[model samples]
Target: MNRTNKLSVIGIAVFTGVAIMGDAMLSIVLPIYWSDMGLTAVWQVGVLLSINRFVRLPINPLVGFFYRHYSLRLGISIAMGLAIVSTFSYGIFSQFSILVMMRIVWGIAWSLLRLGGFLSIIQLTSKTDRGQFIGLYNGVWGIGSLIGMLVGGLLIAETSIRFITTLFGLIGCVTFPFVPFLTPSGKKEPTVQKTTTDQQKPLLALDQFVLTLSTSMVMGLLIFGVFSNTLSARIDQSYQDNWTFMSFAFTSTAIAGIIQAVRWGWAPFLAPFIGKYLDHTKHKQQALICFLLSLSALFALIGSINQISFVIVLLLLFQFVSTGFVTTTDTIASDLAEKGDSIKVITFHTIMVDTGAALGPLLAFGLLEYFPLRVVYLIASILLFVLAIGWISWLRKKQNDPFAFSVRK
Candidate 1:
């Protein structure tokens, strides 16, 4: 990468970390603080946490359209401004209605940031280094989430949720100045051209695209949507009266945050290796099949096992597998875009992600109300295993096709 590209990546990564910190903090704090904030039902917690993702369902494609026609820097800066405002509101408001509204605003902000960050990586990095850069970008920005988890826990235990939330908002504000450092709108660099067939009908690549989107959706549903809420709820129930860490006396909220942190924070180290492997290998499909099968069994185990230690270990393994899927799908999307218009492919994939994330909590919590927690996870496991089989068949068929879409750069 050149100097300008490197700086753009760094700037965007820093901005992403700051932008996501508030949401990450809330993910840990919200379940613990739900009752105190007047929430009575488990489903309400899911609604509060997922409303942002639901809002993104429509907004992601719009943001992508805007990226096609408008100023990327200006759009991202405005989104940052909204993030700051929404974070500030979280500290000031206690009512459920008000909190939901702030979450909506934060959702719009997030859609912009997510799309902008993705575009920046795609536009700024050279084709050869795209996977490595995407991996690095995800790793770098993931640190923001990691810090949010740790700091949010400590603040809630020692100080106050209000203070920590507002502080995170202020931190988001600090990234406003770096918005100009992002790649300018409507800039495209010349690269090795795609074949006539590759350029003629991008939709012909739908088989690969659909598979990639399915993986992304399942990831959002399982990793971000279901596991985070369920784990926190489980911890809260299991340790109702004894809500403090052993000897150290840290609050259960802190412990929950640590657990969730471990789930997300390992990406920085793992993603680069996964990305490099995909970049250098042709058997990406086989790797993904193995990952999905492992995840299926692990999710089943997580549901059946009652021991907290076992559950934690399973969830951690789930995280590792989830990160592999994330890296693989993203790399695939990037490769597909290389053959045609990137914006359309990325927009469609992001919409699938947001849709799954929006539905995860609603579906998971609803299932929990009717069925045992084990059943919910078992259902997910079964569905994933089935999907894996279908994906394997699809890969076999595609491998035999004369003009199959290649994920290899």
Candidate 2:
């Protein structure tokens, strides 16, 4: 990479790290904060953490729409500015309702940043490098959470919420100035013509748009419902006597990240071999991915039972497999996207994924409330099975004319 590319990469990494730190604090620390504030209801804690995603649902599509019109630089800068303002205000207000409002604003900011930053970063790289670049991108977010949790835990022990919030504010302040350097300089896309005309072409296909949208939404449900919420709840309930299940889950996730990084480090070399087999196999890549996803669902079901400590350890292994599998799916999706639309595809995917993640808790809560944890896990597993079957059926129907993927071109 040249100087400009290096600068862009660094800028993205720094911004991503800082922004994720705030989100990390919320995820890893806010439950304890709610406890301290006497908001002990599981439902209330779920709302406090999840309201942001509900707010983000509306905001994400709009960010996608705007990116179709404006420069990524402008959209992302605006989003970062909002994050900076919101981070500052978070500490100023102590009221639960007010904090919820701030979290909503923060969600909007996150939508913009996530969509714009992901797209922009994709645009900055070439087809050959996208997987590796995305791997790095994904790794940074995990690293950010790891760092933030470590920092937040210490701050809560030794200092105050105000101090911690201020630290995040300082991080935002430091990151703002570097945004300009992140802008892509190598490519100049055609500016939109101002001439009035009928029959304007849509920037993305309807099928492409809808499928990617579904993919994003499902991703959110997978994260919030199954991966994070339901799994945690099941494990927590299983070891109610110990109070260490959640801690172990967190430790497992952190370890999963490290394991994922090690795996991702070899993805570039490994992908070619995998790709060769995928290309030759009768099963399409998309269909095979769906299979892996089904396996993930199966693992979720197994983990949700909370059989024993040994079983939980086995579940953690499954969790690592799921993470690695998702990473691979993302690489495949990015590879298959239409030309010049990598960013939009990714943004749409993020929106769906986050939507699922946000709803995961509420879904889990509902399931757990209405039925046994095992039943809830069974239903989730069924859902994943349906997703796989549905997607595979679609692919089979369209097999004669494969999805017009950029890589195939």
Among these predicted structures, which one has the highest TM-score?
1
lDDT of each: 0.76, 0.60
TM per prediction: 0.86, 0.76
lDDT by residue (tens digit), candidate 2, 199-293: 24243234435654565565567644565555454555555343345455444344434333444344434444443444344444464455456
Cα error, candidate 2, residue 11 (Å)? 2.8
Error of 2 at 135 (Å): 1.6
Error of 1 at 255 (Å): 4.7
Q: Could you tell me which 10 consecutive residues in candidate 2 have the lowest summed lDDT?
A: 190-199
lDDT of 1 at 237: 44
Clashing pairs in 1: none
Task: Name the runs in model 1 displaced over 4 angstroms.
Answer: 34-47, 94-96, 182-204, 233-246, 249-255, 401-409
TM-score for candidate 1: 0.86
